[model samples]
Target: MALIDFSFYSSIYSYNHLFLTVLSFLVSALIFLASMRKSKLKRVNLPPGPAGWPIVGNLFQFARSGKPFFKYVEDLRPIYGPIFTLKMGTRTMVILSDAKLVHEALIERGSIFSTRPRENPTRNIFSCNKFTVNAAVYGPVWRSLRRNLVQNMLSSSRIKEFQHVRDKAMDTLINRLKAEAKANDGVVWVLKNARFAVFCILLAMCFGIDMDDETNEKMDQVMKLVLITLDPRIDDYLPILSPFFSKQRKRALEVRKEQIDFMVPFFEKRRKMLQNPESDKTAISFSYLDTLFDLKVEGRKSGPSNEELVSLCSEFINGGTDTTATGIEWGVAQLITNPHVQAKLYDEIKQTVGDRAVAEKDIDRMPYLRAVVKELLRKHPPTYFSLTHAVSEPTTLAGYDIPTDVNVEIYLQAIGEDPKLWRNPEKFNPERFISGGEDADITGVKGVKMMPFGVGRRICPGLGMGTVHIQLMLARMVQEFEWSAYPPNSKIDLTEKLEFTVVMKNSLKAMVKPRA
Candidate 1:
């Protein structure tokens, strides 16, 4: 009787256990199906792009393309039809090559496309936790910083105030080039001189003092090292592989420390000077550093911290220097390559300002020179894609569903070279601005014929200063000297290398004779 009773209970227990197990499986299946359906619903109408592999997405193809990322994107435009998407690891990057779409998305719906990517280890450290105006996500901090910079340092009134700085720097540059022309048999590599002059100009504006060659060289090293740290790595795409790049990241941190060490002393010195007014010292007329010292951000007990100040000052100097120097490089390269253009430009400069140094005030009368600079920018933008933009929220762009936080790369280089827009687009023709019936507004307002400085709300704050520097430097070079390809019969190689800025693969070596 006992055995029979035990068997009956065991059978009942087995039946109950089986029923619960089946019920659990069914519930789990239902949940998974619901989730998949929800995911499908969420991923509606994403832009058409190269079909990607799971997990890796199109990253392998992108790497295998044997081209710069921007060029690769441009190549895809013909097939993908202007606007297309690429998945890099888990991240979605949308490329906007169509001017209409770029205008529609970045200008019309700017509020959505304005913010930066979420803070990551790489960018956070690079920006001192997004204290910089350029990398900072669009928000109160960014606005405050930008307003302070624009009003104090970069505004038209402010830029005009800093005219003396640019003039002095230009004079020094011309003098140095003259020396080089004499020493190098009328052949000079103008890059060093160009870089030095722009650095000095930006340094004075940034730090309220002129740095000596040694100091300037040291700062240049620091900037180059810092820029080297910014090169994209595999870990940037594959976060799971980040540990392998720990050494690289560590080196970047060390470089940042060195940069801060070099920059922070200026901030402290300025602070001390402000505090002690009676000290025997020449007061700086005005400087971005001085303005930053006085900046008052809401909810902050003090102005920007020294680290933040260092970051901003670094950005001010480095951003303007390399980009402007590159412009001069490319402009000079084109002048060397297209001697007819050079002759026309020299004639214009000579007519505009006879035997006088080209000054900021003189830039306006030289329209041909202005057109040359615009053409240089169109042909060889220092930055292929303007600093990357990220989506603030999920939205449709050009009738495609763009999800929140995806990367958006606007192809400025491609836009400039689009055959549909410009006649003989590949040719370095400055006269296009003069007679081509299309506008040459670099500011991207009258439509983006060329956006070397980018467009919309996030347009480079340094655009005004950069344009002035490039024009003055180029004009002065033309006015004061005759430049030609070094070692006659050699072509000025326009081969490009993607550096911190797109630079001449070979440094511009040219023969320059000082004009009587």
Candidate 2:
């Protein structure tokens, strides 16, 4: 019995050991092959860049660089040419720095590069799986959302409709500035006021609710939470670590809950108002919310759910306010730095509008003022890379083969500052835009040189609204007051820090006095 037991145990152990050894070897071989395959794929067809490490890819490069991530991409421009690729996590990221290449891909082949990557989980949760227009994949829902937003809120005619809203908001800003000028001895923080003004305008347009400073500040904090929660987190990129890093997810959940609590009431209030036909006086006015509520797609009976509605509203407010405010701040900063430009703008506004406050309609006659806004947007675009775009299928861009389902980033700053495109690109000169006999069109349809609001099918839906907002605000400020660096000899610090937008590192604090 003992002899039989020993033989049986030995045989069983030998077979089990053999199987375990084989399995381990197979796993090692498979991993090695996968790595080799990825390495091979990277070499062939892809545009040139530093060979990012295996698995983690270029993520380590991003972490170790200790610089704004976009600047890291910019540093590679000379070495890898304008168009290059970086493998980030399991995704392939293609960066287009050449204006011609960007024009070719985003403008010429718009549809192919219009989709978004599945890279950001935080965005997915925040968006509720493509509920918002910006986060949606290229499909029917995206089309409907974009079409609805553009037709109702952002079309040229629609922008004209909201001119009164812009003027009211500008008045608030002007009055606040005047008060600050008097109270602070002519030194005022420009960005805080700019943010408040822009937020108030957008909030009013979004919900038909005029925002006082307190309400505006409250919503501003919520929107900031939205931005923070929605931003790409480390756990999002390396999902394997998500279990250990639940803080971001928890925060996102909390923010989402807060969003629902904050936004659902607005929806319900409008819904109730619409339902009650007898109370015409109390009925909600036509606004972005009303449009969203009334939206009817061809095939759908039920419109966007409350969550989707909230996300859309949040996106609308966030997109319009931050980018527009950033542009206004940059315009003011530029004007302060180059007083001649400011004086020229002031003279143009004064000649056209006189002592009367600058109006939205007046901006049309003030070409130099328009040029100033364009030049400012060109020099300091709110977003360095317009929201990341992806290809739904394999496509060729600028004579390079692009893999399917890869992320693409168009470097707006690179195109804006190209030496070939503009003379002395770094210089603050609005004249370049007008001197060429045609204004440098911000809309990329005419040309793709510098698109601050992006270009092509995915161009920001808020372009018209934002352009008008900035131009109106800038013209009014220039018309009403003189802007200068707080200290006589100090220059406006142009140092930028990237956030939801690229903002001035130290916000513009300028001395102001009413124009005599």
Candidate 3:
């Protein structure tokens, strides 16, 4: 009787399994059909952007050259009419060339239009992993890391303490420029030196190492290794080529391993030194590494593991280098092009600092220099798109659906130079920033205008520190030296080639003659 009962139940169970399987497939089929129908009806809702070739989707179509982002986007505006849709690989990017749209999307409704950078190989590297600023998605971990940076690296108190660092770096930068200044018209790549200074100083703040020539060289090599590994190789975009495209991945692993080997020993050495109470005083004074080891400042108890440490150190650099340096370089280029503005800036600096070395304390007093920086920032922001991010909430813009996890960008470069926002958009004028006569702060103009530091929640946190360095270095250098092009305008090449960041096609080689 027991065996007969078991058989009867087993038979019923088999039928039930079959019935469930059939029902599931039928429901799935209905869902699939409904999705297909919905997809077929849906249309891309954006202003007329450039129509791209089918699959590649405007792969390399952007400002191929200089800070004429207005001109670059204007080429499309005539056709697409201010708002336009563009594609980067399979992803869609809406370019808001108009300032109002930028404000509407990126500022007022920023929760729906915040940060995501999915382009290139970041997705592969960090999607499965949880240890980076670049790859961490828009969520708690990002907020945590960002908050930590604010408290430890970029806070007002920290910056006040680091004023000496900037002052020293400024003195060093000026001394170097004066030393490098030639009697004859010897062309120097001013941008190259500026990039090195920005990275070197920021690295010092990040790792707590005072940058000397040898240390700077070592830092440069590490940064170079990182950049080579980050270049956007096309093979990774397509699936079939993925296996063959493992070379970059392999190279990155090897590079990362090398980075770890370099940083781990250094970290341990610092850690041991920090263990000593005497070292704690000198140690906290020594570098950012020791500061992390001491108290649980910034929520993180200690520096990341060897690999993570190196990546974070590298992250401390990332855009902070290329972007600021590029902006400053463009500032120099613009000043060089428009000597009238250059004379005005030099006059202001001379009136304020008066042949004496620009004391770091005096920087806040120099409004025109502040204006020059802000105006340049307004004109030539490096990233046409703010570091891209996906929308985490259902949002609407221009009556279009911004579905959750959909990617978006704030085209600050486009928005900052919009004719409607500025009195004279195309002209390079610094007076636009001097609102309170000569005593106003120009670190950034919020809401009314988006400075290059970016706007709202995901704005560049390092703005104060970053801006000070550029102004101190570049302004001092320009004031202390007389820069002129390698070849006079008739023979000068004005071509521009923008790579990881923008560069003069021929490089900004100029004769650096000492003002004295």
Candidate 4:
């Protein structure tokens, strides 16, 4: 009886052990399969781009290519199509050249793609930690600053109030050009006088004070120094390499100090005027500084600091000056190069304004003048690329997975010249705009055929003001003088060199004779 009981217990124990072993193996296999599936799901499908060496990425290749960064990317378009990736140090940049893809990302997914990438340390120092409208992150601070600018200063009514300022500046510009032409044998440097004129207008609007030529020149020089400091540095892309760029960093800080010292007195002057009610009321016109003083940013307990004020003023002045001046220069160059276009434009101006100065209101009446400005901007955008944009969240652009931490840039020139979008894209034709292309929205709201001032929510708030400046100046220039290429029959060189804006490699030099 005992032997039979032992045999039964032993068989039961063996059966239980076998069942537990099989259950453990099944669980392990299932976990392994699940992990494999998860790994596959996490794999990102990034855009096609030239492969680079580990760590340093395409930095060496780009440096070795001996081409401007934009041109380098332009060359790659044939290889990788419109959208492609470039790895610069630890940073990943996605370049979009296709209008459809640009519209899709910057418009359809604007909320996700409108934010700015983290600025470099140097830029942050100047921007007061991204407090200015152009540099601020996409949030309450940006909304508050941008709203303040648009409503208070750039509004249509407000712009109309500044007409006298523009008129005075125009007079100064025409006088300066005529004097220079007289002194230099009917030859004048277009950009130099154009920039000074625009600067005068902006300086008055910014500080509510009209400075003499000497002071204006000094301020211009200081602003130029500030812009030089703002240029991109090697350390900006690779922070780990920052220690080597101590000299550059030191110079940037020094320039920042100089900027603050130069601008603070104007702030104090404005403050005093605001405080003393008995001060000359005529001398006190509403200025951007006035608005900044009263501004209440969303998250801040107090108004912008003096440092922040300097940065904001810099942004406002720098934003309008080089861009507007560059546009004027390019427009004049195009007029000189294509005399037929100039003649047509001049005839339109003559019919509209008729021997009088081109007023702001007259700009609205001339359609061909508008077309000429559009074509100039299309061919020579102020900047090669729009302000750097970033994704608010990880998203897919077209078929490619765009990570949240990458810089997104739209090649403005490439889109403007896209063969698929414009017929005979290489030719300088304003007539296209008068007909089918007249509907071409520079705002890129309806659809993006060309985006000179950028598009979507982050589009340049100064778009209206900027266009007005360009059109009015171009009209006045053409109506007041007969412009021809310098040195008699020499061709106006259209070769571009990138600066704060894409400026002509050889600044436009023209011979001017006053119109009858």
Note each model's CA RMSD in angstroms: 14.6, 12.4, 13.8, 17.4
- Tens-place lDDT digits, model 4, residues 1-516: 000000000011112333323433443354545445544556678898998644446765676665677778889999999899988766888888899898898888889888888767887889889998888889999999999999998888998999999999899899998899899999999988888888888898888876778888889999999876776665565566578789988998999999999999989988888788457464547799999986899978899889999999988888899898988999999898899999999999999878778899988899999989888888877877887788888999878999988988888878888888889888889998887544578878778988888888788888888888888888888998999998899988889877777789988889998888
lDDT of each: 0.75, 0.74, 0.59, 0.81
Off by over 4 Å in 4: 1-43, 277-284, 436-438
Tens-place lDDT per residue, model 1, 153-231, is 8888888987877788878888898888788788888788898988888887787765678988888898888766776
TM-score of each: 0.89, 0.90, 0.80, 0.90
Residue-level lDDT of model 2, residues 159-213, one tens digit each, is: 6777777777788898999998899899888888988888887787788654456
Clashing pairs in 4: none
Ranking by lDDT: 4, 1, 2, 3
Tell me the spans in candidate 1 whose CA falls farther than 4 Å from its real position: 1-41, 277-283
Residue pairs in clash, model 3 = 49-85, 115-389, 116-388, 116-389, 187-510, 188-510, 208-287
lDDT at 451, model 4: 84
**Quality of model 2 by C-alpha lDDT:** 0.74
Candidate 1 at residue 295, lDDT? 80
The CA lDDT at 447 in model 2 is: 74
**What TM-score, to 2 decimals, does candidate 2 have?**
0.90
Q: RMSD of model 3, in Å?
A: 13.8
lDDT string for model 3 (34-108, tens) is 445645655645544666433444433432322243345556667876566665434565555565565677668
Report the number of the highest-TM-score candidate: 4
Model 4 sits at a Cα RMSD from the real structure of: 17.4
